[model samples]
Target: MNKVTTIDLGSNSFRVLIYDCLNHKIINEYNEVVGMADGLNETGNISLEAQERVVDAIMRSSKSLEYDPKSAVCVTTAAMRLASNSNDVLKYFEKTTGARFKIIDGKEEARLTLLAVKYALKRERIDSSKFILLDIGGGSTEIILNEGDNFNSKSFNFGIVTLTQKYLTSNKLIEELDNWKKEINLFLDELDINLEDFTFVATAGTPTTIAAIKLGQDFFHYDKDEVNGTIVNLKDLDESLEMFKNSNNETITKLVGRGRVEFIEVGIYIYKAIFEVLEKNESIVLDDGLREGVAIDYCLNKSI
Candidate 1:
């Protein structure tokens, strides 16, 4: 059946996706919030607690899935990139989990993400020659502009987890909103392309969560197929924010999944900011992202 597993060791979560290369279908999937970048903003290193969580998640998932850790295509993102002790952390993960994880730079991260998004667009039959792809991650945000055969991408350092740790957890999200928007705008302005001509598309947690909420689906009932290609309007996003704000801890967790209640607000804030800056009232949300891209890239390279 030619099944292969891909692990995305994200800053906020660890995701394992198994894909059948021969059939081009997903075999199984698992995700756990490890908060790998917890306190990374201040400590300049991944916390021992966070590292332990990752190792534990990896060990459990590897055992449950019965996948060879050495053969899995595992990639760590922004957290590892920014961590001062990433090498030590990587070695530790290898020793404990038997998984060798490669830390991908922001640009490479964007490229791999693009592959998945492109595949989704094609599968959904969304025909567009020009589009702007936004991926809001835990430690970095990547914006990619794809027009015909040309592509340009930029990665910003601040993301939901980092922003939450730096501001929201301190009750400063409101105070820091303007500055955050300005920083995002600065990066967008550099693209120097007329955004009006491009279709805005968003991937990753924020958009998918918004899509699920808009569809009235909670974590337990969340369906990726239904979420994919859903259009999220700005007004709906604002309303969702309000709903999240009013909801209690249990409700928020029920809606957004565990380990995400605290981060979702900051994530939505980032999502709204990007939409407003690009002058778009709505965006096409996709459920496919980096992990899917990794699997697809691997299969293509192997001619599977």
Candidate 2:
């Protein structure tokens, strides 16, 4: 079988995913929270402690890649892009794990994200000529507006972790809500997206986690078949918001796990804001995106 793996060095977590292309099976998958963006905003760099943990996580994930470096494609996102010390961290990762880490800019991130969205739509046979493809990550959000083959994408600096750090986490939750609303609204309004006749698709952890909650469990059981084409209406999203409000860290942790527990509430709100501003009714959820896009490129012998 043709095996391909993609490592996602995210702001909040590090993940390694391997797929057996011939058999269309998942061979190996691993995830760990490293809190890469914990103090990113204040220092504009990946902290020493977080950098240490990131190196450790990458070394652990590299175990599967040692045998054949050609089998895996590893990439880092916003956390690295904005960090002043990112080059040092990347060099350390490469030296220790023998993995070449690539830093993708906003447009490249969008292109790859859209590639994954197009792949999912084709694979699942979901019909839509023009739609928005969105990925909500821990450090950044990649937004894609697709009108047939013509598409445009922008990467916003605010994501679950970053947004929470910037505006949220306080006793005055309502006040924080209004404060963040103005900030995120400005960005969305500036986009001037007219999605009135388009479908909205959401990928990455937040949307999937919201969809997973409907499964009625605290532990997230990642099933792409279940999450890939799921539709999340704003009404269901509102219920998620209320549930988070009544719950504490312990309760939220049980639902979405660590590093994600606190950020998810704000993540959901990001979705709400997007739909409200874009004037879209619902968002279609996809389990695959950036990682899958990398895998697809690797399997095709194409540049990733």
Candidate 3:
């Protein structure tokens, strides 16, 4: 079996996952939550600081992937796609490190996420209609209406860091979040989406963080088998929201994962809002997503 690595350079983090492509299984995964999106607001772009750090992280990983740097496909989403200076970032990374990173648009990101969900359900032999896939990214959230192996999708501007900086202005962030929730609900209501027909497949850092809290774990350790059909109470998420509001950023960084500390509460708001919109008090976390989707795409397409 051939080994191939996939790099998903997301707004909140940069992740590299190596897989036994033929066998369709993960071998090893490395990630760093650089909060690369931190200064996106100030510069109207992915910060030069982030670009330099990203280059260093990728170069570090490149040493380990020395066998075939060409086999590793690095791609960026949301933040890069939305940033004004994204082209410069891409060009610089490619020029300095010889790593060509593609900035995927919303539609392609949606397609990859859809592919991820499908691959997961097929591998596990679970019903495809079982859940609605939600990927809460740093710059955006990708929503896929999964129904019996076919899905309809949408990419929204709702993101944890963006929301935190934009709306988490007061203790009344929850109420303000309600307005955002209303938009989600209105969109779904317009579509007449069937809530009972679907379970929630929450992905990305935000959902994972909420899941970690629910399990009372302090780190990012979770088993897909343990979580597959499990559900998390919306009220538990609501409790977390209150917990975050009470704590300071420094405390949050100390307690929760590092990169997400400052915006964890904001993420909670988005997650809780989705729970409310779905009208289900609970959600299931899928630790597998995007990167897996990209790997599966490479495998099936023989991208290597």
Candidate 4:
């Protein structure tokens, strides 16, 4: 039995997972908020502080991993792609830990996310004529369009963390949510998507956390079985947002936890806008994403 470890160096967080490929099970997983894209919008470069934090997180997670780095698949996404000092940071990481990281571009990111979601869809027995997958990360958002078995995608630079920080000081950010919906509508139009005919499948932290909150799953104990394939209604989501608006950061943290609570306000707006533009009243949440997709690909494509 081959044990495969995959690490997702996400913009908002760093995650490491060990999977039993033959058995199709995750043996161990660890996720930590490294905020690789923290203040990136303002700086146009990855800050020294953020880089240090990310390096520490990676080192700690690597220490806990059971598999070899030479064989493990390490993926770096949005934040690394956009950062001016990405090469230096990556080289430092590789030299320090002996783990080589591959920077997956936007289109590839979208494809992998859809691949993982499709796997989840099969696992859950959800049937649909066509389906679309969207992942809202810290530094970018990827939308995958699926017509039958064929897939294509569009990637946007805006994401929960970056979007929030971009408009943090705007007085009309809250009231201008509808305007953002129009922008997304225009973007979707450019992609020539047939939104009316396809089911919406959402991935990433925001949707999953929302599903968890709605199902009353606390931060200490989250069940993927309950979250994956979970349905999210826009009306209910609005209610949750309103509740968050009325509460303090401590309260919000208690609900969705640290790294996400800070971005939930913006993330909710993005979700609301997309669903409204697509005329989707609800979306099915999927817990699996790029990490799973990469791990599966490595296992299947490697030499037997």
Candidate 5:
């Protein structure tokens, strides 16, 4: 059996997925909500405290792998990619644990997101000629417009943590929303892409939260395969947003799924902005994206 584990070190969270290639199943998975991207706007760098937390988390996750440490592949995304001293942190990890981590660029991020969406959907053929692939991470968002297998993807620097630091926490949530809306509208107009040209397929925590809200759950279990193509309407999104915004930190933290309390508002803003821009009423959620995309790439390359 080919055994492999892929780790995604993101801005707000670190995820590890250990796979049994022969069975095409996940054997072990762990997620750590470590907001490494926080305070970037103020510090202009990742804080040393955050760095230490991430390094410790990575070390612990790495030790959980059934295979050799030398065999695991760790990739860092937006947070590490933009941090002024990201290379230093990477070097530290390499020196301490002998784990080499690669920083993936936006294009690669978008491409992997596409692969993950397709695999999650398990669609052999696509009937729609035009569709949008979206992944909203803690520190960035990748938007892809697909026509069949060929498409265009652009990664935006905007994300929950960045937006929150700039807008929400400052008591300027409405102002930030307006400005973001205008920015997205300008971009869409420049691309000459109309709302009718595509159907939205979103991945990541944001979409999943929307799914839980749509299902009326304060706490519930969600399956990626089950919710991959789930559709949520504007009304449900609005209600959820209101509920989340009205709640205090403790309340939001207790809502459902781990680590959403601090950033759920940003997730809502993302959904609201996208929907408002497109003049659409709903978004289809896809549970599979970047992580599974990593899995697919590893399997195809027989990297294990």
Candidate 6:
């Protein structure tokens, strides 16, 4: 059977996936949160520590997975795109890990992500004719509208990590909520599309984490099959937010994961704002994202 590997060097995490192309199944998967964008907003560049973390993650994951770096479809997103020293960082990563990475633009990122979401919907026997896909990442959020062959997408600069660094760390989370909502609303207004006409589907960590929580799964017991295709209601998200607010850091970490405790609240807040502005009460959550998309796209191009 033909096999392929994919690496998603995300702003908040690094994920590696091994796929059996012929069987259309995943062989193995690994993920680690390295906070690649931790101090990017303040410096406009990737910190040396973050760069070291990424290189270490890449080497370790590749070594343990026994995958060849040369053939892997490795992609980096918003953090790299916005980093002024991305070229230098990429060179350092290549020299240290022997993995070539591509910095995909927002449009390409949306396209690849949509590819994964469509495949997941098909596997779940759901119609994908019309839907609005929301991907809330660490450095940016992508809003994609798909109507048959027509597609429109936009990427917003604010996300969980950046927002947390800007507001939560500064003790302005509560005070800045309204301003954040207004900013998101302004972007939605620019879309000029009737959001109510499309089904709302969300991918990435935030929705999947919410789905996991709703399914009574914790970090140690997460089941992607149960999390994927799960319908998460706005009320459920609000309740989760309240619980997180009242709970301590350790408790939140047990549910979401180690590196997510600090950003979960900000992520949930962003999701709530999006749902409120779009009048979306519920969303279909999926675990499949850019990593899956990269593998699928690679297989397709190779005619595997």
Question: Local distance difference test, per candidate?
Answer: 0.89, 0.78, 0.75, 0.81, 0.74, 0.89
Least well predicted 10-residue stretch by lDDT in candidate 3: 220-229
What TM-score does each of the candidates earn?
0.95, 0.88, 0.89, 0.92, 0.88, 0.94
lDDT of 3 by residue, 207-249 (tens): 7666666776665454545555446677778788788879877
Q: List the residue pairs that clash in candidate 6.
A: none
Highest-TM-score candidate: 1
Q: In model 2, how large is the Cα lDDT of residue 257?
A: 87
- lDDT of each residue in 116-231, candidate 6, tens digit only: 89989999988899999999999998988888977888888878998898874435765565676677677768877787789999999999999999999998899999998999
The global Cα lDDT (0 to 1) of model 2 is 0.78
Question: Which residues of candidate 1, in runs, are more than 4 Å off?
Answer: 169-177, 183-186
Q: How does candidate 5 fare on TM-score?
A: 0.88
User: Candidate 2 lDDT, tens digit per residue, 122-185?
Assistant: 7789975788877888888777888888887778777788878877554444455456557655
With a 3 Å backbone cut-off (N, CA, C), the pairs that clash in candidate 5 are none
lDDT of 5 by residue, 69-146 (tens): 456677888988888998888888787766677899988888777876776555623344667766888888877887
Of candidates 2 and 1, the better by TM-score? 1
Root-mean-square deviation of Cα positions for candidate 2 versus the true structure, in angstroms = 3.0
For residue 210, model 6's alpha carbon misses the true position, in angstroms, by: 0.8
Estimate, for each residue in 126-194, the C-alpha lDDT of model 1 and write its tens digit.
965899999999999898999987788988888889999887453577557567668767776887888
Selected candidate, larger TM-score, 3 vs 4: 4
Stretches of candidate 5 above 4 Å error? 63-69, 123-129, 168-171, 190-194, 216-222
RMSD of each: 1.9, 3.0, 2.6, 2.3, 2.7, 2.1
